[model samples]
Target: MLHCPRKTARTLVYSGIFLATGLAQAFALDPTGDWRVADGVANIRVAECNGSMWGAVAWEKQPGGRDTHNPDVSKQNRPTLGMPILIDMRKKPGVDQWEGQVYNAKDGQFYSSTIKPLSPDQMEIQGCVLGFLCGGETWTRVAGPIPSSPANSMAKGPPKSPGAPPHTAGMTAPKTTGSVGPKTPGQKLATAAHPADPVGDICLLPDIAGFAH
Candidate 1:
């Protein structure tokens, strides 16, 4: 059988493209886990939300800290311990990075954020203000099984540590008595619910239906 040179070249090119795409998809990183941030001062739980990923502060050193610097006067009094800071993070196609917005509780500013997994246990998080000036930190994964239910996960407050008197401005300190363990599948939901402000109209990606909490 006679073979054309052009046909052989086209077959090689197609094969290369297929392999590249396959590798990208195979190695795609999932950022759904617990991450320690702010030099271990806080722990945030990242989970699936509306086809994307959203993270909320699951634990903090100072559980009574309020959003004192928030731009909105009404929200300034809200507790920062359980606030959602990582919103609507979607994996960029054919890449190892996720793009989203990160809300800084200290300054109450939202910045363009990118998350890249350096390894299974570590991630590099970068937030930029003007697409030029940027700052970032390496976040380490928290070792534990995340709570099974949304209510169990979101409602549980951080364990208290021995420290100075609790800051008593806007919120009271979370009770330090309960065990912060993973809840069973059929665990009864708490009667008093923790408030999760809706992220409606704040998500950069409109296709996402917004987070429930």
Candidate 2:
């Protein structure tokens, strides 16, 4: 069979590009898991929402916290436990970063955020507002099964407090909330020994009526 050299070269180039794109997609970092944040005082569950990614406060050191600092007067009364703090993160093409907005309940402000996975068990999370000033934390993956239901989580109650008894089934705790600041020198990111697992429905949060845009 007669063959054209120029056509063969073009075909080879196209094949290479196709393979490269496929490889990038195949090895993309999957951030669908529970991550320990705020110096291990809080656990935020990252999951897929509406083709994008979002994170919600799955568990806090203190339960029954409210979004007292939220700028919106009405939303201030909302509980922070299930609040969607990491909002609408879209994966950046050909990279291990995701760009989105991060809402800080402590300051009641939304900042531009980017999440980059440094390893399967660790990721760098950054939030910036003034363009130049940026703060970040290295979040480590949390292992084991996350509470499957609100009832189950409440049953387990907040992490044990010295001299405090476990909360009753129906009783709620006092609200206590704090801000997540930049990691300081010598600050260690929390780590877990269990293997990473898909968050599944355990971390899914209710859809915010108008949050997605």
Candidate 3:
């Protein structure tokens, strides 16, 4: 028969408790949900994409509800809609952080970015094009499912203008699981709409570079 000391048993119990506490904290800090980021300059909403950890901005509210600066948009006199913004984010080892690219749709520029979630409902995003000239923004959690296939519709509608702003709504991501399911056409389409890029394995908006500046 094997025997264990009382002190060893106590140590094992404490270790197990510590591990559980850490896991709970991690779950609480996971920033996996719909979020809204708006400054006086712009208002944008994004949701997690299906099959990938990346979230895409599906809605953009033009600042002031009018394009007073650009004549092209002024001529149309319409709000910016359907703008794709955020890229896919992959978790980094040993930290509660995600790193990915952030493309400026208006200028077709890509920046190195990092998202460190402060809480389940808050995250600090730091983006930099030239490394030193970095800008940071904080995003607040929004009430919507994370972007996914069910949320994004494939019903072909009226022809959208070539210059139509990127989308910022219409889908949410799903929780990661090990269960494998048969793929369908809708799933294939979703994968096409938000293709995985070379920079990361996470799914993100394929056309996020075209967002209005």
Highest lDDT scorer: 2
Report the error of model 3 at residue 199, Å: 24
All models, RMSD in angstroms = 13.4, 12.5, 12.6
Model 1 residue runs over 4 Å out of place are 1-28, 144-213
Per-residue lDDT of model 2, residues 136-201, tens digit only: 999877632222122222222353222212233443432211112122221223223212322223
TM-score of each candidate structure, all chains considered together: 0.57, 0.59, 0.49
lDDT of each: 0.58, 0.60, 0.48
Highest TM-score among the candidates is held by which one?
Answer: 2
Whole-model lDDT, candidate 3?
0.48
Better of 1 and 3 by TM-score: 1
Lowest lDDT 10-mer window, candidate 1? 197-206
Report how far off residue 95 is in candidate 1 (Å): 1.6
Total clashes for model 3: 24
By TM-score: ranked, best first: 2, 1, 3
